[model samples]
Structure formats: C-alpha cells, structure tokens
Target: MTDKNPDKGFVALLGWSLNAIEAVDRFDRRYVVVAPPWAEDYCRQNDIPFVPWDFDRLNERSHELALTLEDMGVDVAIPIFEETVEWAGAVNAVLLKNPRLLGQAMLFRDKSLMKRRAQLGGIRVGVFEEAHDRGDVIRFLKRVNQTLLKLDGDPNDPIHFKAFDKSGTAGHRVIRTPEDVDNIPDEEFPALLESHLDGWEFAVEAWIKNGKIEFLNISEYVTLGYSVFVPATPELEAHRERITEEIEKLIEVFDIDFGFIHPEYFLTSDNKLYFGEVAYRPPGFNALELIERAYGFNGYQGLVLAFDPKTTQEELDAFFPKEVVDAKGHAGCFGVYPRRRVVSRLQVPEETANHPYFEFHELSDPREQKVAKRSAFGTHWGLAYFFGDNAHDLRDLLKRQEELDYYV
Candidate 1:
C-alpha cells in the first residue's frame, strides 16, 4: 500500500512549548497547530494556523481533540508539555482504533510504569520502592537503614534519602532523619523511598522509531538546581554504550514509537551507572541546539520529524553525526526563573543581547502586578538563553543575571 495522502497533510499539536514547535517549523512541510488558547494571537502573527486545545486536561481534552482532529485527518499529535503525557494513553487509544495514525503513547505519565518497563528490558535505573505515607516510607527507610548503617554505629545514625514519583524534583526530597521522614506530606508524596545514587548525573538523549533506538548523545549534568543545566565532562561520562543498548531493548519491549526521550542516570564512584529518571519529551535544557551545534543535524528537529510518517527514522539518523556534539567553548549554562514564580521583569543590558555568546533571552512582564509562583499551574514568567563560543563567558553572564532579584 502506498503512503500518500493528497487531502490530509501534516498537523501538529503544540502547547506553550515554543521550542519544540519552532524546531518543527524548520521542516519544509506545512503544520496545522493545536495550541493553548493564548497562542492564537502569536499564531496569527506568525502565519501558523491555530486550533484551540487545553493541555491541562488530557483525557477529556485530548480525546476530544483526537476526535476533532480525526475528522481533519492529522498525521501527527505531539505534546510539548510534560503534563500532556496523560494524553499519551488517550491518543494511543485513538491511534489503536485507527491504525493509520503514526505512533503509540504509553508509560509516559506514570514514572513507576516507565521505570519498571525500562528495567525489565535491562535499562540501568535507580532502586526505587513505591510508597504511600509514613508506613510505606518507614518500611522502605528501614530497609535502606539496615543496608547502609554500619555496625557499632550510633543508635541515631542519620540516613540519606531520596524519592520517586510522577512529579520532577518536587516529587523528590532529601530525608535525613526520622523526623525529616515525617515531614513528607501525604498529598505531595506519591511514590517514595528511593536509594540515592552517589555518582554524577548523565542524560541519554535518543529517538525511538519503529522500535529502533537512535542514541543521540549522553549529557552529563555538571550543575543541577532550580533551573540550570551545565554539561558533564568526559571523566564524568558514564555507560553511554550500555545505556544506549538497554534503551533500544526497552523501546522494543515497550512498543514505543517515533518520539524523543531523555533518560537520566547516575554513575557510582566505582563507575557503576544507576538510572535516575526519564522524560518522554525533549530535554529541559536546550540540549538539542547544543547537540546540533556539535552535529550538523538538529536533534529537536529530528524529534519533530519523527512524528511525520513521510519522514523515516533512517533519514533522521543519517543526518546525525557519529561523534559527541559539544558546545563551541568551555563552560556555559541555562537557567529558568526560580520556581513557578512569575517574571516581573527580566532586566538584561542591550550589550548582553548583542553578545555573540548570548543566544537568546525571554522575560515575563512584571508590569503592575506581581509574578505568581506557587499556583498548581502557570507558564514561565521569563527565560534567558545564553550561548557563547566560550563557555566561560556564558557562565559569567549567567552569574551577573542571577544577582538581579525579581520584584514580585
């Protein structure tokens, strides 16, 4: 059967995920976008067609969107938000019902399922126990305590702690004591009690197409914080080949399809690698651009292409280079506004903007009102993107930007 659709072209659903959609824009094909309602004006200005869709409500909204787009015969539905992962199953349901659709979505939301599936396929991940409250926490902590505690130790020996759940960083906490254990709120804790990895962090970036894993790059996390990602050095680099092989195994075992994945891991002092976490989307850092800088192909753009049936994975892989992609200069990093807080103003001197190292910057208008932070949901108030041939220059500029306080 020939894969040709004269009437139905490609359609892409994007939320506030500007980078992913913009990356998709690099392709020659036309894209019909289903995005946040707020994006309508931006779409109009950019000459991209806009369809209203709420990324917040996945089951209902996505199912509704699936049906609506079914009529339009969209070839692809890609989500930019981590939250939209809930729609993965729903979209899969629709895709299964209609096999013509390009991909399947599963294990994208629940971290436990994601890890369990990966481990069964030989993926090296952290040892995690799913816990509910004090009982679960206590039981799991006891196990960790027994394993780590030394003989003739103090009766009140402190225990290092970590956690796992659906939420990122928020789902994790450092538990130092029994008292600290109790501090874990019932509502906030979902899956808990994970043994902390002592080694440095590395991220395996890949694209799974037709059950094939294309290992793009392994990124080491130099500095991790509220909103910063620095690169890892060669010494810090961990099991790139093993991780890639295992991930490929998981893709087949799980039956995942054309999509971008970021699998995080930690290497022990002995060089033993442990899985940390995985995101079904692109890297939080503009790691794609960095990868592209190192390799001629665009990692983010390849992700977008994976959604289009006309674009084959082989074609995408051919475009990527064999060597590790690196930033041109020494040390550099990127940061988001601290927390969910609003960006009252992102004050950057014009000099910084004109700098060759300064790749991009974004700011939320503080204006008359304060930037809101603690809400269950809100977009980034401001973002500052920096890129320099010299990593040191980028680092220095970030240091200067960090000193300025947000008014709200």
Candidate 2:
C-alpha cells in the first residue's frame, strides 16, 4: 500500500473500476475499495486495499458496510457506478452522520422522483409519467401525441420509455405507436415514460465543492447514442454561464452539498433550457478519459478530489483547468456496433485509421457472427477515440464514423 497523509481524508470507493483504482492509487489520499467478493483475487494480486461487499439491494445489512468502514476510520465513500450510487448514499449518511444523503442518492437513481423534485424546485423539465404496464405505456403515448393535436393521418410524436433505475440508455426506447409499445417486455414495465423534447440535448459534468461549483464541462452528443465530444462547440459553450446557474439550482433542489453531478439538459431553439435527468456517478462514453485528453487532468482523480471532504479549496483551484480555454484540443469517441447483422471480422477502414485525428481504438475480431438487434443505444463492440484542435471538426468526425463500416 502507498503511504498516505494522515491529514487527508481516507476514502472508500463503492465499486470496482480499474480506472478509478488507478487514479486513487496514484493520488495522495489513502483509499480502500468496497466491491463484490469476486474482486478479492485481483485486489490481492495488485496489493489494493479492499473490502468484499456485494451491492445487492439496500437492506438491513446495508449498515454493515458503514459500520465496517467506520471502524476502519474511513472519512467518506465515493460511488463509481450506477449500482453503487445508492450504496454510497446509504453508507455516507452513516459515515457523514447525515441521514438525508440516502434520500438524495435515491433521487439520483429514480428518474420519475428526480424530475418531480426538479419541478418542485421550479426547474423546467419535459412532460413525464411513470408506466406500470403495456396499457399504461400505450395510454401515455396516445395522450402525449393527442396533446399535440395531431390529425388522424399525421404520424404520432415519439415518446421515450426507460427503466427508472437503469443507467443511461440501458433500457431506453423510443415509442411512436401502439405497436412499438408491444415489443416491450412485461418485465420492463414500471418504467418512466417521457414526452420527447424538441431541442439540442447535451450533458454537463460539474464537480461541486461546499455547495458551490468548482469546474463544469459540457459534453456535446453528436448523435444521441453513437458519439459524443467534449468542450462542446462554441454555440453550446456560449451557454456556460447559464449552465452553471442551473447546476447551482440543482445543488439546492437535490440538497447536494458536495461531490459531482452529471446532469443532462435540453436547449430548445427558442433558447429555453429543460432538465432531462441527473446522475451522481461518472458518465458513460469514457467522458473522464476525454476530459483527461483534452484538459490534461485525470478525471477519476478529480472524482476522488470531489468526494474527499478533507480536500482544500487551494487544491481544487489548482487541480482543474479553465473551461474551454485550457483544453489542449477537443476530444471525442464513437461507439462502434456492427452495421451488418452477421459479421465475421473487424476492420478499421483506411480513411478512419489514417485520419490525423485518429488516436486509437478499442476493438477486437468479431466475437460472434450474429449481432443482436440493437435495443435502446444498443451494445457497442467498442469505441474509436480521436483528438483534434477544432470542436466542429471533432463533432463532425465523430458523427461521420457512424456510417462507415467497422465489421464485415
């Protein structure tokens, strides 16, 4: 184990992420990982401080992790995954001696409750409702389109159906008709249905300190599920001040005093902003990695800094780079799924591999010849990452990647 400073807070990581572990391992804070028992062997081999705890549903035994970590003198807990967000809340409420943290975590986990909280706080959000069955989903779809006053021949406006607790896009579906609702499995009921917002959708990753904003990065999604770029284009970056204020309001509504918030938003053509949802853990699409590549700071380490109560103001001031100005270049990644239903191999088209912006890719030979029909965002085989000086070019580059063949 690395020598730790006694003055610094000892953090407990609430999930197993190699990137997070490497980050904490290299940082100054003393840390221990609380993960499933299956990870014990890997931790033992790497000499990582670890405690085995299966993050099943929160139950009576939930307090066990808190008591155990308390005895070890742990000062705080940080969640690195969606499953652990509630667990982090449950334990931190005990460790921090604040019972409300658990409720805040639940707000972050449940989409319907979160939107309700936002609305109660005077935040504008898309029309949404909880769905309990296929009948409910169909009724919601018809009602949403009916509100638009569509003629009988006009196509129904799309509505979004998603699992209340699953992380981004896991169980997401866009329904435009009663037939579309039929494909939904019965088990997928008890979901959240939202009227689709017509606007530019983007997400923000902000690290809050002592109930204040420290640093915020806007992640621009070129294509909702396929590709995303950081240090968004000048058009989106223009809203920095407005975005910051919204996040501060979010801090108030969620009663979030510290740590990071990954909230998604929609900017209508009229310049009105709408709240989509917020998550308390790291974002998908390797946003942390993109932030590191563009701004020259480790995002995982930033996560640790955000959660560590002992962190000083001076340290945060020095840790994060100044918004878009400090970005060395715009960084982005494209998720790759086989375009063809049946493919035997993987190939990086020369046009892509030879591009100046191409940095590297994480892909392997086809594991299976049959590609399952993509649901929601679908399961991507891997990601192709790029870095460049122009955000527009980066955005276009990421979007262009969707059409090119990667598997054949």
Candidate 3:
C-alpha cells in the first residue's frame, strides 16, 4: 500500500479502473475500490484497499453499503463509470449528509431527465423525446421530419436513439427512415430519441471547485465515436470564452460544485452552441489519457483533488497547467473497427505504421474468423495512438485512417 496523508479525504471509488486505481495509488488522498466480487482476488494480491459490492440496480440494500463506508470514515464517493454514478451518489448522499446528491447523479444517468432539466435551466438543446417501442420511434421520426418540412422524396433527417443509462455508444443507433426503426431490438426500447443536430460536435472536460471552473480542456472529435484529440485546434480553441460560459451555465443548472464533468456540445453553423448530454464520470475513448499526454499532468489525480473537500486553492492552482499553451503536442487516438465482414487476422496497414505521427496501437489478433453484424455504433476492436505538433496534420492523419484496412 502507498503512504497516504491521514488528514486528507478518504474516498470510495465505486468502480474498477486500472488507470484510476493507479492514480489514487500514487496520490496523497487515500481511496478504497468498491467493485464487484470478481476483483477481490486481484485487489488482495495487489494490496489495494477494497470493498466488494456488485453495482446492480439500487435497492433497499444500497443503504447498507453507504453506512458501511460512512463507518469507515469515508468523506466522499467518486464514480469511475456510468454504472457506478448512481451508486456514488447514493453513498455520498449518506456520507456527506446531502440527499440532493442522489437526484443530481440521476440527472447524469438518465438522458430523458437530463434534457428536461437542461431545458428547464434554459440551456439550448435539440428536439428530443423518450421512445418506449418501435411504434414510438417511428412516430418520432415522422414528427421530426415533418417539423422540418422534409418532402417525401427528401432524405429523412436522421434521429438518434440512445439508452438512458448506458455509457458511450453502447446502445446508440441512428434512425434515418421508417424501415430503420424495424432493425431495433425490443430490449432497446424505452430509449431517448433526439433530432440530429447539424454542427461541429466536441466534448469538454471540466474540473470544478466551489461552483467555479478550475480547469477545462476541449476534446475535438474527428468523427463521432471514432477519433478524438485533446486541446482542440485553433479554430475550435477560439471559442473557448463562449464554451467556458456554457460550462459555467452547466454548473449553475446542474448545481455541480466539484469533481469532473464530461459534457458534449454542438456548435451549429449559425454559431449557436447546443447542449448534448453530460456524464458525471470520466469519458470513454481514453480521453483522460490523451489529456495527460497533451498536458503534463495526471487527470485521475485531478479528479481526486477536485472531489476532496480538504483540497485547498493553492493545491488546485498548482496542479493543472494552462489549457492550450501548456500542451506538449496534440495527442489523438483512432478507434479501429474491421471494415470487412470476415477477418482472419489483425494487420496494421504499412501506411499507418510508417506515418510520422503514428506512435503505437492496442490491436490484437482476431479471436474468430467471422465478425458479427454490427448493431448501432458497435464496439471498436482497439485504438491507434498518434502525436504531432500540428493539429491539422493530426486531424488529417486521424481522418485518413478510416479509409485504411486494419484487419483482413
């Protein structure tokens, strides 16, 4: 076990993530991993402080874990994944003696509720509604297209279907026509549907303290769910002031005081910024790692500092570096999904491997010869990393990867 400052907050991390665990292991603040029982043996071997608990849906038994952590003198609970966000809130509400925290976490978990809350707070958002079945989805698609006055021959504007609680693109699908609605499985019903916003989509990572923004980094996406780079290009960077204001508004609306927030936004051609959705935990696609690569700082440690009530202004001020100015270079990653229907092996294209920006990849050999049909935004096989001094070159390099074959 690493030495910890007894005076600092003792946090309960309500999920298992190696990156987060490694960060807390080296930081001053003490933490305990509250994960499923499967991790018990690993935690014991590694000497990691652990409390095993399955994060199933909350029930009457949920308070037992909260009381247990409170008895352990835990000051707060930090969620590392979407599944644990509600768990963290439930536990923190008991530990911090604030019941409202649970409600706030729900806003981060449920997309339908989140949009309603954002709209009530006067945040701009695209047209959206909850869908309970295929009929509901079809009706929504027709209504959205009709509202746009889309002619019968005109291509229907696509609408998005997303699971209320799943993270990333786990249960996301794009419905462009009535026939497309038939492809949705019955289990994926009770989802949130939204009109596709035509604009530049980007995600913001903000660390807040005392209802103020301490540090914010923009992650520019080359293609949604495919590639993203930190400390966005100059054109996107120029809107920092406007973006910051929107973040401040999010803080006010969400009543968020501390910890990290990963919220996505779309800047329309008209320059109007529309709120997408926000997650209370760290973003997927290795965004924190990319941020750490671009700026010489540990983002998971930043999460600890932000959540620790004992953290002082001097500590935060000294921790994060200047946004774009402090970045060493642009760090980006492209998620690789096999383009072909069947693949016998994983092959990194020579053009990709020879590129100056190419750093490395996480791809491995194929486990099977047949690749299944992808539903919605399916999972990527792995990611390829890159770094360069020029953002445009990095962006172009990432975009070009989509055309290359990574498997055969």
Could you say which candidate leads in lDDT? 3
RMSD of each: 5.6, 1.0, 0.9
Candidate 1, overall lDDT? 0.58
lDDT (tens digit, per residue) of candidate 1 on 33-124: 77668888988898666788777663546667777766676666666666655564466457446442222344656676777877787767
Provide backbone clash counts, one per model: 6, 0, 0
Query: Residue 278, candidate 3: how far off, in angstroms?
Result: 0.5
What TM-score would each prediction reach against the true structure?
Answer: 0.75, 0.98, 0.98
Cα TM-score of candidate 3: 0.98
List runs of model 2 lying over 4 Å from the truth. Answer: none
Structural RMSD, model 2: 1.0
Q: How accurate is candidate 3 locally (lDDT)?
A: 0.93
